[model samples]
Target: MLTLTEAASRKVAEIMSKQTDPVAGLRVFVQKGGCSGYSYGMSLAPEIGSGDWVGEFGGVKVLVDPESAPVLQGVRIDFVESLQGSGFAIENPNAVRSCGCGNSFETEGTAAEGSLPGEMSV
Candidate 1:
């Protein structure tokens, strides 16, 4: 079960209210990039193709693609702000390992083969 904190829910609602397009929902995908080999991606999108699992949480709609669902199960999304900066954070209980940047995760049971938790050195 994917969940969102109150702050995240409000922020998402505000962002969606400003959109003019007819959207299927926000999408959560894991990409290979950033200081971590995996990064969380959010998109206020209007379209969804097949194999997209729609997750409705915190009174909003979110799309989690099939490939990413296992890695993201029981994850909680939260928004954090400090005097220095503000951003979204993830509380992933399933992660066996995570990068320092908090963008990547690797699970003990099903990590991709040869995929490191952090990005490649330049």
Candidate 2:
């Protein structure tokens, strides 16, 4: 399962509190696209699905679909503030290669073996 840093957890909780509707948790998923073959996506989920993997960190809930769980395993999310900007950053051990923006990555075997479809070599 993925983990969230203290700053990330705090930021999530803060965002959730400002929402008018009740938030089930933060949903993390992977979709086909990006220069590295896959891009990470996140949103505030309304509820958990039966097949979802649910976990809590620093008092905030996190939801992941089965399809993304394996790819996201051992991932770490942190909130960063810099002179350029402030946003969430992800560190994924399963990613053998990633794009310059860090929002997309390619896992081992999938892209290395030329099995990835419509994915550009980085």
TM-score of each: 0.78, 0.88
List the RMSD of every prediction in angstroms.
Answer: 4.5, 4.1
* lDDT (10s digit) by residue, model 1, range 9-83: 778887888888887777887676655345678888788758787877677788887767766788889888999
Runs off by more than 4 Å, candidate 1: 110-112, 115-122
User: How large an RMSD does model 2 have?
Assistant: 4.1
Among these predictions, the greatest TM-score belongs to: 2
Worst 10 residues of 1 by lDDT: 112-121
Q: Compute the lDDT for candidate 1.
A: 0.74
- Estimate every model's Cα lDDT from 0 to 1: 0.74, 0.87
Tens digits of lDDT, candidate 2, 1-122: 99999999999999999999989999988887889888889999999978899989999999998777877889999999999999999999889999997778998856765434333557
**What is the Cα-based lDDT of residue 120 in candidate 1?**
43
The true-versus-predicted C-alpha distance at residue 100 of model 1, in Å, is 1.8
